[model samples]
Target: MKKLKMWLPFVTLLFMLAGTLTLQAQRKQGVTLEGYVYEMDEDQKFPVPYASVSIASLSIAVTTDENGHYVINNLPARNLQVTARFLGLEEQTQEVDLSKQQVLDFVLLVSNFRLEEIVVTAESNKAGAATASKINKTAMEHMQLTSLADVMSLLPGAATVKSDLTSVTTASIRGGSSLGTAILMDGAPISNNANMQIMSSAIGGSTPSTSGTTPSIGVDLRTITTDNIESIEVIRGVPSVEYGDITAGAIIVNSKTGRQPLTIKFNTNPNLYQGTATHGVNLGKNAGSLNYSGDYSYSVSDPREGYDYYRRVTARIGYSNTIGKWYTNTSVSFLSALDKAEPNPDDEQDVTIKRQNDLGIRANTKGTFTFNRNFFKSLEYNVQFAYTDRDSYFYDEATNATVAYSLSKQDGAVLSSIQGNKIYDVNGNLVTNVPAGEESFIAWTLPSQYQYDYTVDGRELNTFAKVKANFAGDLGATHHRMVIGADFKSDGNVGEGKIFDPLNPPYRSVSYSDATQRERSYKDIPFVNQFGLYAEENFDWEFANRHLQISAGIRYDHVLNFGGGLSPRVNASIDILPEALTLNAAF
Candidate 1:
C-alpha cells in the first residue's frame, strides 16, 4: 500500500505525458493555459477573494483565498489572454506567452476606493482607512518568543543585532543599539541594562575562557508561557505616550484570564536542549481563573558546532480573577551549564575539553489591581520583576607564556593554579548544588571581589510597573486619542568574590595551596533607577472619497549615567481601495 501510494503520482504524470505525446502526433495543435488571479485595488493591493477571474472563451477561471494566495495548473505553450472582473469594480484583461508547465500570477486594480462617505461605519477592523493591519494572533500563539530582541528582529524598521547571547537574549532596533532600545513588559519599562540582559563578561580567574555574571538583573523570558498569553502587541517603531522613552519599538503582552473552569495540557518531546515534560492546569472560583503550567526536560546532543551536550528546564504559573478585579503572574525557569567545549589554556597546547558545573535561574512576577468603573473610573495598575544568576569554572583568561613546574613547596618556590566557581540566585532565592567553600576556609574582602574567601548568601532584584485608564479623552483638534502614562524601573545587585593572594609562599611549585587558592573577599551592590513619559496620536483626511491617515508619537527617557533622551515616530496609510487595503509605512 505504501509503495502504491508513493508511485501513484508518478503513474498519473506518466499517463499525462503519453497522452500529450499521442495527442500532439494526432493533431498538430495541443495547448493548455493555466494561471491564478488576484483582484488588486487601485493601490496594487490584493483585496483577497473580492474579485473573480475567468476565460470568457472556455469558461476557465479561479478565485483567491483570504490570504490573497492561489495557484492554477496546466498552462499552454503558446500565447494566452485572461480577463478578470469584480462586482462594483473595474474589469481587466491580461495577456501572457505561456511555456510548457508554467505558473503565472496576476495583480488587478479596483476603480473606486472601498471606504467612501457612506454616513455609517460597519465594524472597525481597528481602523477607518481602507487598509488593514495583519493581525497575527495565531503566529504569536504558536511561538514562545523569549526576548524583546527576538520579537523586534522579525518586525519592520528593526534589525536584531545578534551575539553570543542571541539564544538567551540580545537585540537592537533600527539603527539604534540594543541598550538604546526601550523595553517594556505590560506598560512598565525594563531596566538594569548591564545585567537585566545577559553580557559575556569574563569569568574573572585563571580560567577566563568561559563567561557569566553574578546574581543580577536579567530579563526572564522563559516565564512567559504561550498558553497563558492572550495577545502580544509589537510596535516596530515609536509608539504612543501610553508608553515611555523608547526610540526604536515596544512590545505589549497581555496575559490570558478568566480561570473559573479547570483545564490541563502536557507535552513529551525530545529536543536539542532537553526532552520536555510540560503540564498546565487552571483552578479558581466560579468568578475567575488561576492557572499554572510547568516544564522539566533534559537535552544532550553533539551540535555540529561543537557546543558540548548539556541540560535545561523551564516552568511558569499565572493567576487572575474571574469575578474580581485583581490578578497575579509568577514564574521561574533555570538553565544549568551541563557542559561546554573549550580550548586548552596552555599556549603550546591545542586541545578541547568538556566543562560542567554551570548553573543559573530566572524568575518573575506581575501583580495587578483593577478598580470599579464608576467612581474609580476603571483604574488599573500592574507590577513585574525579573532576575538571572550564573556561575562556572574554566580557563577564564590566559596570556602567551610557558613555565616549568617541578619545584617543591619547601624549595623557596611559589606555584599556583586557579579554577572558577559561582553561586547565584534569581529574584530572591538561591538555586541548588552551588559549591560554597568550606566554612573553615573562609575570609572577607570588600567593594567587589577575587579571593582569600568567605561564604555569602546574596540576592538581586528588579521591579517594573504599569498604569492605564480604561477611558481617555481626546486632546484638542488633532484627534490626539491621548493615553498618557509613565514607567518606573529599579535594579539592584549585591555580592563579593573571595580572593587568595600569595604570602611568601614557594616559588614555581605546584604543591603550595594546591587545593586552597582563595585569599580574601569583599561585597559590593550596584543599583540603577530610570523613568520616562510617552504619547501617540492619529490623524485622518478624506479626499476623492478616500482617506489618508497619519499616526505619530514621541517618548522621553531619563537614565542614570546616560542622562536622558527623546525619540519621535510616525506611520501613515492611504486608502487606495474600497474594502480596506491601505499603503502603509512607519518611520
Candidate 2:
C-alpha cells in the first residue's frame, strides 16, 4: 500500500502531461511534406531507397520508401533547412519554404575521393544534441587498426595504448568500470552477462593467470575486428530512453552495407600481421545487395621469445533490401579467437601452459516500415540472437614441501591415507568408501611433486527483440518527434563448468584454511530475463528568432525474479548565436 501510494503522484503527472500534449497537437495547424530521393549516373536517374531526409533545425526526419518516396505530416509552416543523405553518396541540403511548397526532390551524387587524400579524425556531434564522437572508415584505415580496441585512442581526453592481443581489454567510458558500458553492433547489444568462468571456489585464493576472456566485466574488445566496420559512435553523455542497463554510456558500431567494390588488404608490423577482404554485389534490379567480409590476424607478445601469442579469424555476411514499404537489413557473423602462453623448456621451474579460446556466432535483422498516416510516421523493429563457446585451460607443475590438506568438502572430515578404501567419521561410524582413482583425503608425507591442470567450459546465449513506433506532429509553434518502444532480453549459460582430476587438484590456498575445490556444472544456473518499455518526446520551438530544442523521456525495466524501477531523463539546448553557439544541459 505504501509503495503504490508513493508512485501515484508520478503516474498521475505522466497521464496529465500526455493528455495536454495531445490536445495541443490536435488544435495546431500543420503542413505535410513529401518527396522522392534519387541518384544520377550519366544522364540517368534511379530511385534510392532508404535515403534519409531530415530538417536539421526542426529535428524531424524520415526515410524514403521502396519507391524512393517519403511523407512527413504535421510540420510547422515556415522556412526550414532540409538535408538528404545516403551511404556511399554525397549529402545534399537546401533551403525551402514549407508554407508555399509541399513536395521536394533530391538527386544525390556518388562520393568520389582517393583514400590517401582523406583526413583522419573523430568528428564531434552537432550542438544541441548529446555529446558524441564519430569515427568513419577513413579514420579507421589511417590508423591501421588491428582490433576494435584501437579506436579508443580517437576519443577526446584518451591516450593511445600500445595494441597487445595477448591481454584482455574491455571498454570503459568516462572513468566508469567496463561493466557499466554497453557495446552494440548493428542495433544489437553484445552481452557478456552469462560468463561465469571462475576458478573453483574450493581453490579459494589461488588465482590463475588467464587472458583473452572477460567473465564478469564486459565484452573483450580483442574479439571484435574492425575490417568490416563502417562507422563507430561513442556516446559519452546521456543517451535516449531506448538504451537501458547502462551507467557510463554506449558504443554503437555500424557495419558496412549496400553496394561496394571488392577490396583486399594486408598489413604487417613488428609483432602483428593482418589480412582482410570485403566485397558487395547487387543481386539484380530490385533484389537487393549482398555484402561479405573476412579478417584474419596473428600477433606475438615478444618477437624474441614468441612464447605468448594471439590469433583471430572473423567472417560476416550481410543483406539489405526494400520490400514494399519496409526496408530491412540482415547479417550473420562468426568469430574465433585464441590466446596462448607456451612453456619454455629452458626454464625448468616455470613449466606452465595457459590457453583461452573464444568462439561465437551472431545473427541479426533490423527493419523499418514507413507509414503515410497523419501522425504515425514509421515503425522499427530489431531481433538478434548470439551464442558463444569459451574454453580455458591451465597447466602447471606443483611442488609442496610440507603440506597435506583434506579434499573432503565437509568441514570436519577425517584425513586418511591412500591405502584406505573406506572412510569413517569421528564417532567411528562408516561415512563412505573411496572410488577408483580417488582417495578419502590427503595423507601424503612431505615433499611432494605433482602435475596439476584444470579446464573450464562456458557456453553463453543471448537474445534481444525490440519494436518501436515513431510519431511526428506539431503543437502550435513547437515541432515534435516522439518514440515509444518496448524491448526484451534474455541471457543464459549451459555448459559443463569446471573439469579436473580430483586425485591431483591444484594447490589449495593457504589463506583460506577450510576451503575446498570441486568441479561444478553451469547448466544448473537460471536464465536472466529483462523487459523494458520507454517513451521519448523531442520537440523544437522557435520564438523571437531563437530556437529551443529539448528531449525528455522515461524508461521502465522489469527483471524476472527481481524488482524494477523507473528512470527519467531530459536534455535541453538553447541557441545563443544560431549555429555558432549553444547552451546545453541534461539530467
lDDT of 2 at 214: 55
Q: Whose TM-score is greatest here?
A: 2
| Model 1: per-residue Cα lDDT at residue 88 | 24
lDDT value for candidate 1? 0.40
Please give the lDDT score at residue 444 for candidate 2.
42
Which residue pairs in candidate 2 collide? Answer: 202-516, 202-517
- Tens-digit lDDT track for model 2 on 1-587? 46446656755665555556656656653788888999987789999876778764443567677788888777666777788877666668887788899899999887654455534343223322567777777677767787878887778887876666767788998899889898989988999898877635465647565556657678889888888988888988777788888888889899988766787899887788899999887686668888899999989878776888999999999998877667789999999988889887678888899988989999999988866354566788999999999898889877652355556665555556665656777999986644444453564433467788888898999999999887666666777667779999999999888788866776655556555676678888899999998877777788877878787778889899997788777778788988788788888
- The TM-score, computed over Cα atoms with residue i paired to residue i, of candidate 2 is 0.87
Kindly list the per-residue Cα lDDT of model 1 for residues 62-168, writing each as its tens digit.
44443444443333344455666542234566776655434556665544434332111111122122221121223432333322333444454445332122133
Clashes of each: 62, 2
Lowest-sum lDDT 10-residue window in model 1 = 118-127
TM-score of each: 0.50, 0.87
